[model samples]
Target: MTVLVTGGAGYIGSHMVHALVDSGERVVVLDNLSTGFAWALPAAATLVEGDTGDEVLVSRLIAEHAVEAIVHFAASIVVPDSVADPLGYYRNNTVNSRNVIACAVKGGVKRFVFSSTAAVYGNPDAVPVAEDAPLSPMSPYGSSKLMTEIMLRDAGLAHGLGHVILRYFNVAGADPQARTGQSTRNATHLIKVAVETALGLREKMAVFGTDYPTPDGTCVRDYIHVADLIAAHMDALRHLRGGGASATLNCGYGHGFSVLEVIETVKRVAGVDFPVELAPRRPGDPAAIVASSEKARALLGWQPRFDDLDTIVAHALAWQRKISAEGR
Candidate 1:
């Protein structure tokens, strides 16, 4: 049985593709290439350039490929941009996801794994938020993902589809082998931005909001290595295939670091003191959002290997340098 991975050309999706192919799984990628690069995808996975909302195309691919599962990673993820274009966010994230889930049901796909975000928690009332925390999304991006989660839950009950929704915290780092990494130009991910700056690709980076309630006065986040995050998806897929019940799990290290702390690590790891400007807070940014990942550990038997902050930064820096050398 093949696994169809939507957005499989993007950063995290590309990593998922690598992991799946490494495990000897038949993989098919469906991507529009809006922000994802076709070169990021491995040659082993069949790349289908199309929108996930196109139900007819999706159904045909599922049928032809004998796809038994889907790992969906397609969505608009920028928080501030989502705030500026709430309707667009809803259409791309929620409405499109509904269409994909519909296609899965029609195609008789058994398992699904969704790439969700911790933004769904917004500014949680407490740190180390559990999976069952109240749904309070502060941005359209988060709200859009939460809406998709709701649809998956409802669809499972209505159609007997087993699914896993893994709500990820801040995902960073590259494939340990440097085969693929965050290759998107003008990307907004914190570690990406910092690595670019250190490599002289960018002059400097900004630290939004330095007066929050956190110790360093900047927003705090639980950063998980991209490899470890993909491992969680693999375990989730295995669980669903083995008749495990549907689950919504938080993917993180159960801790967090402030913005300033991450910047310091980047500088230390790269040995380049890139300039950073403290700027006003961006809209939809939470003060601090950590995770309680016990459920993922006990339920999926996921073991994170690269949980260190410096190691994550080093891997990201290595990828950035490689990109710079290749003139990409």
Candidate 2:
């Protein structure tokens, strides 16, 4: 049976595709080229250029490929952009997802893995945020994703849809093989922006808000390598396929790196000291955010391989060099 990956052409989704393909699983990818490119896909999987919300296309693929599972990754991810366009965020992240799930149910897909975000637990008072933390999303993007999580829970109860909701914390790094990375046109993730600045891809990058009561007076985020994070998803898929209960687990290293520390790592690894401006904090940015991934570890028996900050930065830097060389 094939595994269907929505938004499989994008950064995180593409890595998941790689992981699935290497495991000798038949794979089908559905992604609109809005922010995704066909070039990011591995040769082993078949790519279908279409919207996840397209019921006919999604349903047909599930049946045609005998798809047994799905990993939903397509969404509008920018916090500030989601703020400026809440309706657009809700429509794509929520409304479109509804369509995908509806198709999954109709097709009787056995397993589902969702690409949720840490933003759902906005401004939590706890560090190493647990799965049961109070969810107070501070942005439309987060709220929309939270809505989908709720829908999945309700649908599971009503339609017996088994699922694994993975709440990701600041995914970074690239395919260790240097195949793909954060290819977004203008990504604002702290690490990506910092790495690009080190490569002279941009003149400078700002450390958003240095008065957030953090150790270095900057925002702190738990950054997980994309490769390791996808490994967690693979484990989640196995759990679900093996009749494990639906789980909402965090995908993070359970620790964090402040914005300053990350920039320092990039500078140290790239062997270049770039310019950084200390700017006011951006809205919807939590002062410090980590995760309690103990459940993922105990349940999935997953161990991380790329947990070091330097290794993450080095992989990202390599991808940046490729991007610059290819002029992509």
In terms of TM-score, the best-performing candidate is: 1
Candidate 2, 1-328: lDDT as tens digits: 9999999999999999989999999999999989987899999999999998788999999999999999999999999899999999999999999999999999998689999999999999989999999999999999999999999988888888899999999999999998889999789887889989998889989888988888999989999999999999999999998999998999899899999999999999999999999888687888999999999999988799999999999999999889889999
Candidate 2 TM-score over all chains jointly: 0.98
Task: Give lDDT per model, in order.
Answer: 0.95, 0.92
Clashes in predicted model 2: 1
Candidate 2, superposed: residue stretches over 4 Å from native = none
Report the C-alpha lDDT of model 1 over 149-205, residue by residue, as the tens digit: 999999999999899999999999999999899998999999999989988888889
Give the RMSD in angstroms, all C-alphas superposed, for model 1: 0.7
lDDT of 2: 0.92
Over 4 Å off, model 1: none
User: How high is each candidate's TM-score?
Assistant: 0.99, 0.98
